[model samples]
Target: MALKSEQARVLRRRVLGGLIRNLLLFSGAFALACLAIETFMVPSIANWVADSTSSWRTLNSSEQFQQILTDQGLLDDANLFDLWVNEAVEGGYTNDAGTITEIQGEVNEMEDALAEYASMMADSPENAEAAAAHAKERAEKLGADVAVASGTNAAAIGDASTFIDDATALDAETDNARAVPLLPYQTILTAEAIPTDDASAAQAIAALRVSASLQELGLSLPEAQTFMPPETTVDAATRILVSAAVLGYDQPTLNDLLQSAFRQSQEQAYSAWLDLTSAEEARALGVSDENPVWQIQYGEDGVYRMRDVATYTFVKSFKLPLALLVFVAGWLAIILRALNRSLRYFDELSGAVGRLLADKDAPIELPADLSIARNELAVIRSQSLADERAAHAAEQRKNELVAYLAHDIRTPLTSVLGYLDLLRETTDLPRETLRKYANIAYSKAERLESLINEFFEITRYNLSAIPIERETVGVRLFCQQVAEAFFPEAAARNIRITVDAAGAGQFFIDPDKLARALGNVLRNAVAYADANSVIAIAARQDARTTTITVANRGREISDAHLETIFEKFYREDRARSSKKGGAGLGLAIAREIVVAHHGDIEAASERGVTVFTLRIPTQGEEIEGAAAAPRIPGATEGVQRPVEPVPPRTVRPASTRATSAPPSATARRGPSARPIPQRPVGERTQAPRQGTSPLNPRNARHGQVPARKTVRDNDATPRRRGLSR
Candidate 1:
């Protein structure tokens, strides 16, 4: 089954979608848990605790307390009211005493002012009545202000003069009152109260003196109230008794009586209040305690408090367990679902790999599902199958190579032995016959040698990297030498070979290695090129690269063969029996050499013409001690060699030309032969053939070729052969 493309895309989307969805789910779960804790669980717990505890001694029933819980939620609002109540209760009664003290102080100041004004009026009887009246009005106004501070009615100011007289008499009577011990009462009053401008100092002093007098008599609250003056109103007597109690004058006894009475009254009032607001009663009031709301706490001190104790305590008790349960359940479901989908695919892949490993010939079987195509296991399976196929093909090639080598070597060995045996057995044969046998033997031996060398060459290339012994060589001269060496062979085959070395430059190369590599290409060209056809050899150079091309008009190589033509043991002639085909190692060896020098070689064939191109770097890597070599003449220093002059070519048919001029520095063929242009060294030039000239006449007219000294070849070293693959 074929893999589905849409399925693969869908699988990717599903994977990413699953990841994102799971992340959101987990995040959402956590956020919900937090929200529940903050909004519901925490508040519920706080409300429950508040309802359960006593708020009568604290402030759970206060308006501020209820508002805090309603506004801030239960957890933050907890215990807030208790804090406020404690503060208020500690200072409440003492504040009242301070108010009284302030009012009395203001009244005393008014009396002193009035007394001073009256004395001034007495100095002048005519001004006496006016002064007295002014003083009285001033006194009345001051008394009214004092009355407001004391929490007394403004009507009390009507008797300001009389009140002043009584105050003075009281002050006189209290002169000896200071001698009495009242340290405990004073300390209690100071702690409870801080006198302020609003309080009546005169009233506070009177209350203090009364309390002191009562303590000296060791009277109870009732006994002190009874001793109050007859003219004193019930309100005045009650204030005296309360102040005495606050100042620690018979404090323990008075506190017990007051608490008992207060408790009795508060218990009745609170019971009635609670009944009115009970859950049953709340429904009638349109207030539902569907959640049983606040607990009622009534204290011994007659304080009533209520708190919410059900909602928070019940919620806090179960929120975490519920949240945890939900989280675990969700995660488990996700894990199980993921495993259900993935585990089977993984298991199947593992089994397939195991089978393949166990039996080398076993075919790999993978799921057709495109969802699994991008999985690691699937990739490994695919690669393993491909490697197995490649290994099988390679083994078949190796078997064919061994058989071909055996036959090729045997044929040459048999010929050489047979020729030598003929010479040995025919002693009476003619000299020419003897010579013929010897020559045959020698030729066979050479063939055998060439075959052996080919095997060695393959082994050498395969064994390790090929090292280059580099030297500076004139590229143009090198091409000339190669062409000259092949001239005799080409003449024998009725084929013409031409060399074009226009604008070729000096290059650093391993001369022997390069020669061998070039020989392989030339040998292939010579073997396959049609008889009487031109095989063109061209060499040129540019700034960085030196290019050499061997082109011939011959059988066109197929595109498939052209790609693998340089592969070891690969031959276009699949028969492996062609006499000229030497084990198909020649071009492969050439490629190895060129590649080792960090260069490239390629082959292309079109319209019965095959061309092999080699491009090696001109400024190749230098070996140690090779930098100081003398430069070639007519070769530019640190630059490409200039194009040499091209002598006119003599065109002739293939049959008419017996000898060719020691081919020109830039050679071409036929009537179209012209001076080849000088191009920058390392520049790539097209492959040369019958009709193509490197030079353009228009370019030559423009003086593209620079005038320079002609280079002459002076080295007369004899040419060596047997380098061709």
Candidate 2:
């Protein structure tokens, strides 16, 4: 957890690298947007409209658009309506040219649709045959000249109307896609109806004109008629086109009629404006009906803000520039937003560190742009949790071992001191009685010595001293030797030991250390296996590796205890008696030995049957009864053992101290044993009485000291015992 100064510089460099990369990315996109505006928008604005000329379109400072509109105080005046009207006329509001353009476009679209539909005759044979016949007859028209038919309109308009009606009825009988909608060309019925008002008449005429175009029936303006001041009769409205059916004008079309319509619609307004203006004003502000100004919503409050012509000329005339302005603005906005989010991702990482260490268990989430960062943070959080759990478990194990050591030390010291006191007093006792007290004190002293040695093991064991010594050994022979070592012990309980390694070939391993490892495992089986139940040792080999499985019928190991059984000083049954079990280093040392052989060991239990598996990798050096690998001198294999012992204090019976035992001698358990009384350190406990020892069940909780007995020099040799604590 300690941090160093060098890491800060490294972190800053990483931050700078990411920041520079993102900025360069945004810079590239900005450059592309600028280039697009220049290529596609600049030229379009330079010559905005096709009609623009150098004479009318000046870009000099003196003729800048801002200066042009402000030169004549035009924007200072409120009378901008005349300009607005002139512009309105240009857009076909009071003229028919714009309407004609719209009509031509719509007609073209309908023509294309109709042609494609009619050509589908191959797909619709019956309808195609009838339509083809009618088309053929019309194409061969005899003497119906279009121009001649229209010129005789004043005299023969009624006959023309009848001819169109008859032609339409015959055409309808054919029932084809070529039949244009009658709503556009029903002039035969139109004479009976006329729009009643000027507004209605104008709209009706517009609709009828469009219909005629769709029908491909060419028409001309109606002849003028006399009208009263209060009302303009429909039949007298010259602005309405004369139906080609009513005038026989469908035969010939005149382009000039459209132009005349445009002029007639705006001439009255221009003439009225001319009469109101003087010669001086007309020269500066006059507008022609032919070249109408662009329309303006002059009543709008801010037209003069950009100068009178800014909206009228600048924005309306130069569309690409406005679009370019918006495109560039939006492009910059998007780039900057993403850049900001990139920075936020870094902040999220910083914040995630705190949450990973805190109580938050949720997975770190981010937008799609930060998916990689999100995934990495999630992985870090998981690893942090795993590390935290391992640390917690290790701490718990250390605390438990300290407690066990304290209890083991206190229990034996109490019994040893109690028996020694019994031997010191009561000198008049029988010889056998003296021997019993002496024997009990000597056994306790030996156990206390064994425990102190293991306490040294906790601090002094070094796993690196013993190197792996490879040897090729038959799996069956190797396992049988291990199991055979425990046969006498197993026979005491009538339990059977069996080895089945039929196909298990030779594998590489350390003979001495592996023998110690397998010895540790078999000892546990012989200790915990149910009396009279079979213990099975099986080994198998494949091309890659060899496996040895030791199975025994015993109490099923709980999941919690199974996980920590391989941890140092961890035993499944947690017994503290020196006569019953070791310091719980057997399985841990076994795992170390197996791992050094480039292999692993695992334990599992189900249905009262516990199994320990040992697997060794065959990829290392080949071996045949090989020599031991070089190792540190005085080093013990499988587990560590102190070379020397700590001398007892002068106040105690130092001459009675027992010799230290090897670790392999530590984990063996007996058939049955009493539990040790556990207590915390620093507690003030009274000296135990000779008749009320803490280990004796008969004494229970009574701690009264025994009456002092008669004194005597009771010098007696005590019986020695095995070194197991």
- Candidate number achieving the greatest TM-score relative to the actual structure: 1
TM-score of each: 0.45, 0.40
Where in model 1 is the C-alpha error above 4 Å? 1-21, 41-394, 425-427, 468-472, 576-578, 620-725
Model 2 RMSD in Å is: 26.5
**lDDT against true structure, model 2:** 0.46
lDDT winner = 1
Give, for candidate 1, the lowest lDDT window spanning 10 residues: 708-717
Q: lDDT per prediction?
A: 0.50, 0.46
Candidate 1 on 1-725: residue-level lDDT in tens? 44366655655566547856886788697888788778877766665565464232222222332233234332132322223223323323233434554345553554454344334533543443344345445656664322211111111322355322333333343332212222222332333343334433433443333333343223344443332222334433344343443333453454454444334444554555556645644443243455555555665445555554455556557867987787778777776776665566567666776876787456656666533543544455555555455445545665676687778888889999998888888789987677667656655665675566556545544443344567899998887766665666567678787777777779988776677678778878877889888888887777777878787887876655654466555667766652565656667656655664566666666667766777777888522221112222354444422212111122243443333223432343212211111212111111112222232211222222222111111211111111112
Worst 10 residues of 2 by lDDT: 680-689
State in Å the error of residue 608, model 1: 1.8
**Shift in Å, residue 255, candidate 1:** 21
Reference-based lDDT, residue 182, model 2 = 31
